[model samples]
Target: MVQAVPDPRRWKALALLCGAFFMVILDSAIVVVALPSIEIDLGFAPSDLQWVLSAYALTFGGLLLLGGRSADLLGRRRMFMVGLALFTAASLLCALAWSPAALIAARAFQGVGAAVLTPTALSIVTTTFEEGPERNKALGIWGALGGVGGTAGWLIGGPLTDISWEWIFLINLPIGVTALALAPRLLRESRAQGQRRGFDPLGALSATAALVLMVYAVVEAPQAGWTGAQTVGLLAASLAMFVLFTVIESRVAQPLLPLRILRSWTLVGANVTMLVFSTIAFGMPFILTLYAQQVLGYSAVEFGLSSIVFPLAVTVAAIVGQGLVLKAGFRLVATAGLTLLGIGCLYLTQVSAGGSYFGDIFLGLLVSGLGVGLTFVTCSIAALAGVDEREAGLASGLSNTTFQIGAAVGVAIVSTVAVSRTDDVVAGGGEPIVALVEGHQAGFLAATILAGIGILSALLLLRRPPVPSPDQPPLVPVAEHADD
Candidate 1:
């Protein structure tokens, strides 16, 4: 059988798919900056506000594996269209929602759509492009777009929220509609060519329940007393469910998660590294935005503008990292990137209530962005490097799952630390605002620790350049032959 090349039309399809992915990723951060406005306009309690973000993330992360598997069993193009339609419809519902419950519900559905779409999108890209530098370059752009979209979300969201928070959802509608129209004309469908398997409903249920319970426990611990029955009960339940999931996976004939993938040290390390980096990357926006608005008293627009530093740096670093990986090697550049990320997080630990934005915050964001940018590309490449074409969908799903889980865990851990410290400062008779700032500083410190741990993991887990297969040509290190 002649190997199939990606249809030229698939390039356009990939672009549209990425555009949709960008919208979803961008929405995650866009809402963070608009949360205050959302709360005031929508009459949301402080306790309920977290769900505005959490609802989307929980559902998206929870259903990712199902979505990926569905793509393989069904068709990538079909799943992509279905996901886009659902996402677009949910966005409309979100824009029209008058009550907090309605908005949260809509957001959850949005997550469902995102879960369906993300893995299928990646699977499509992997299937369309051959496994080599071409795919690496494409995946590099995909990863870079995610980083860029996150930053753009805030920058655009601030201005859009000023116009109307509803505009954010409404905006995705047109783009989504355009993508849906273009998709049929441009995209080709692909799936596994062999025996079909039934969906593992039990495994899916157990895994979703485990993740949600765990995330809920962590999220609630910051608000509810950690010793409270509700917190303890949820945490206990989460642990039990996770243990149950492992047992179920081992017993099931068709496991939702193929446990064997963990045997690949490169894949395991990349997933763990992604988790750590994602945590810092996602959690920092929450901390920094708080610092800007509450501590420095910057307007939303000013804060959004300041936040641009990191994404711009990430965009630059992503391009450079891709070039470097083509020459030096993923190991060297990735280690360096992780180290920069640790340094940047550590730098932010010095930030205080009186810190200047330009002097302290901007530089920290830039350094962290560059570090994360480099690592994101390298880790993504490393994760997918040796994956078989048949197993590409599974690998992509697992990788994306780790990214989501890491983000949730990062936010939860950092938030818990900050909230605990803030409570202490408040109990000490400090001003409420001052206590809040101190809590944020403590969170950044915790984030620094997390990033430092990631660096150590990268050093310990990642090996030198991977040995090529006998049938395959020796792979040149991207960083070694950099033109620049």
Candidate 2:
């Protein structure tokens, strides 16, 4: 039997794949600091501002399963380049957007591209590196890039937005074009050998509609009244669409989301915990962005720089968490992470109108960052546990979907609550700064509740793998590589 010859360009391919992955992840976070500038420039209504973020997340999350399946049916490299072109075009549209609606629409387009790009990129990475140390190293690099991209968003967005909000989106153009040019030379084409070519666009559409409508209803609830016909009707329609998605999934020849995948209790638990975990991870930064700018009167650059502690702490702690997961299993690490998350959010509630960053925000950000790092790493390990190798791409796609969905939902919930509270306080003739502080505090409290639920999910839903005897190595040293 002859052994297979490895691709000589695998490392170069890995670099390109990781670079694209970094850009996709960066887009998710890059808009954070730029939100205020975007709102001002684009005349975005407070209620509609989140659409900039949620629109991207909704489409990204909703279409991911389809994207993954498509990559399997089509060629991974082809889909990747197509996604790259689309994403680059959409970024240009976002930068040139003249109105809120236009920007939101463009962002949704970008998400579609991301939906196609991210999973396919990960698939390519997995296929490029032979399983074992090499693959693990590639995955580790992939995962670390996600963290760095996320952290870089704040730092990069601030300076860019300081110059002009459009710069944040414009920066993607050069990177995307460079990657597109090199992809053919560096990355080989691959696909699932015997998969059917059928698609479930309806399943994807229904799910997206459900999430978009749900977020729309929540974002509008403050002004429309929670129980008003508009809110109630939209919520009902969202539910109906969700039910329709499930039905379509059940009957489809090639379902976008394979229901059987959920049978793995660990995967289910991990995804569920991840859903809540992301609510906090994505929600906190949004509220802080507003609070820092609106209440504390920090410039975009200042807020971005000061908030560096959060992601820095997250990166550092994630490195430390890798070790902890080796000692204790995912269950304990996830629980502890969430506990810390809840405590951090609870601590943040003490923030006041005139409070300083160090006195009021630094500790909470540090603690929450640590929690975010640990929870994401451990929960990811749990999510992939026990899945068959063939379905690895599907499982990874599903996990990524859960995360984006959580981001959409979390931003909706926190933004709605904060805006509503601020409106009420302002209506009562409260000082604007104080009202803003109260609103931020409310948002933090909501995040704390999310963290508490995450803690419960970790404790109750995640299964405990049997401890290996002293002779055997840890059942799996999963901490080395995490799914972002």
Candidate 3:
């Protein structure tokens, strides 16, 4: 009864989808390397510069579900074009801005556009490809976008910043335009057919507001003392908003996120595992970038080049990992990957103040990066597996939400620990470089523990699909785990 997508065009659609996905991802990393340039050009105090990242991240992560649901109502292809146009326009705004206010506002607009486009792209892919190894293969490549974008941003940022930081923002314009032009020709419009109501406006509002406040608190907690009134107040308010959101969703007939969808242990397990590993993976760039610049005295270009290994490893692993998942199954491959990641992080604890990259860091980077590569690809497969087609967009949104929220929480927690430890050592009259390296190593030790826990979680919570009895339904419930 299901109509087959035009197979001949699916691959081209995927290339375009990945292209847009890559541009959105680049925004996340591009700002990190270009922060100094932006600070100088926009006359922002260093503190205000955090908003440059925060504004984008909060909006993107917070409203992802709303955007995803919007696509379910508005049609995926339509949403994609609108998002592309909005993001492209916002990029122009970002490039032209002369003030910190203008840039931050523009970044927020870009985030909204990205939040709209991201999950819709995933849902479109899920719909386009058949649900088997074919879908897995497409998803495997789709999974690479995060790392590819990160690596591309790091590699390309230095050159762009060397010319003008504006170029970093400007580069998105052409990519977005091309995607927009090809999208209507290549992508077909699809919406969930049986929805009782179109938009869950209230659900979207509360969720967006709650996430914004929470992410804002997380990003600011280190800058503002963790115990500061602002931090405490913002967290309390965010919690209240979240509670209200739950109540609203429960009472609403047509909820944006039906509470039932979240009852799936399969989706829950996938997201939890993602959170655990992502908490570790997300901090790697921040810690490594800091080490390269603050401790190693590397120039911007050198630091970017050094950071290339992780994404490169992830890109390679994701390609090969599809076959691995097919053979070994999701739980086993993911658990193994997490074990390797834990071991790699434990090994990285050996880094010293004057540690050589070749001797102390590069091997660990390669090892951890490989682990990350495998882990991420499997996580995607597991999350989407067993999800109802109607809620594929929802699942995509939730998966991304966990990853984004996890990253925000991880960076905050790790930064706080590292900064506290470094300050303590400095106060005791330790060399600043030694103190910083010691602090970074301590964070890595914590990351190792988290990664180890993720491995255990995978072993216990994940399972292959049970053989169906003839009396039972053929379709697996969203709550069940199944081999890819």
Candidate 4:
């Protein structure tokens, strides 16, 4: 048996890949702080403004599976470049958009590009690094970048929006172009070995449609009312499409997502944990954004600055979490992370209508940030731990898809809960500020419960340790591989 030569440029490639991924994650949250400017410049109706966000989420989440599978069947490097090109082009379109409709259309296009780009980029990382401690370290950095991208969006968006809302999208141009030029030089072309070119169009269509409808339903549920006809009808349709997707996958010679992958209890558990983790991770920040802007009367930039503690804590914790995972294993790290997340949310429930940032928001965010950092690294490692080389892209796609869906579900759950509570208080003629604070507190309480569920998911579902296949080395602690 012959061992393959390691790519000399792999580390540099990982840097580029992570950089591009950071941009994708950044785009998701950056536009959020700039929404008011966008609304004014484009004369968007309140109802239509959300579509700018939803458009990106819908396409990105929907196309991830297809994109991942395509990378497997096609060449990973080829798909990466293609996706990058599309994303960069769409960014330009978004900047140039003069009307709400144009911007929404461009944002959706941008998502299509992201859906293709994200999973493929992750697959590249897994393929580039050998499994075990080295891979875990790389993924830790990856997880940290995700946390930073989301946090920095608020920080960066505020100043950019002040200059001009279009700067947010325009900013991607140079980054994208530079990456495109560097990619061919750095990334080696690879694909699933011995896989035939046969494609599963029906399975792909059904799965993509199911995901798109599901994301749309959840994203719109708060506005439409959860029990309203539109919500129910869309959900039912989404469910039916999912059923069809499953049926198609079971029968197809080459399925988009092989059903057998679900048999891996470790992978399944990691994705479930990811979904639950994202609910709290995404939901808590959302409520805080409202609390800072609405209740504390902070401007976007001020809120961004005040909120910097969270990302800083997350970055430090994530680096530490990599070492912890390499020493203690996935289950312990994940469990501890969730415990902190729940405690953090519980602390946040003490927020008052007139609370100060240092007194109320800082500590909770810091605690939650630490938990987020650890849990993200743990989940990222666990998701691809025992995956086969051939299905690396599929695994990456599934992991990302879980995160995206979890984000949508999280925001919806919190928004619905908070709005209902706030409406009740307002109906009773309570002070608006007090009612708003109570609503945010309710949202934080919900996050605390979700974090608890995440802990259980980690304990129960991730019980069996990952068993490496015959071809690969078993995952070992960093101490064992320090010299590598």
lDDT values, one for every candidate: 0.79, 0.82, 0.77, 0.83
Best by lDDT: 4
Error of 1 at 275 (Å): 1.2
lDDT (tens digit, per residue) of candidate 3 on 263-308: 8777888888887877777655556656665677766677667768
What local lDDT does model 1 show for residue 350?
76
Clashes of each: 14, 0, 0, 0
List residue ranges in candidate 3 displaced over 4 A.
39-50, 99-101, 219-233, 465-484
Could you give candidate 4's per-residue lDDT for residues 92-186 as a string of tens digits?
99999999989999998998899889999999888888886788788989999988887788888878887898999999999999999999898
Per-model TM against the reference? 0.92, 0.91, 0.89, 0.91
lDDT string, candidate 1, 235-277, tens digits: 8998898888889888887777778878888888888888787
Of candidate 1, the 10-residue stretch with the lowest lDDT total is 475-484
On the 0 to 100 scale, the lDDT of residue 256 in model 4 is 80
lDDT of candidate 4 at residue 80, scale 0 to 100 = 94
In candidate 2, what are the lDDT values of residues 455-483, reduced to their tens digit? 99899898763333556422111111112
Positional deviation of residue 157's Cα in model 4 after best superposition, in angstroms: 2.1
For residue 139, what is the lDDT in candidate 1?
Answer: 82
Number of the predicted model whose TM-score against the real structure is largest = 1
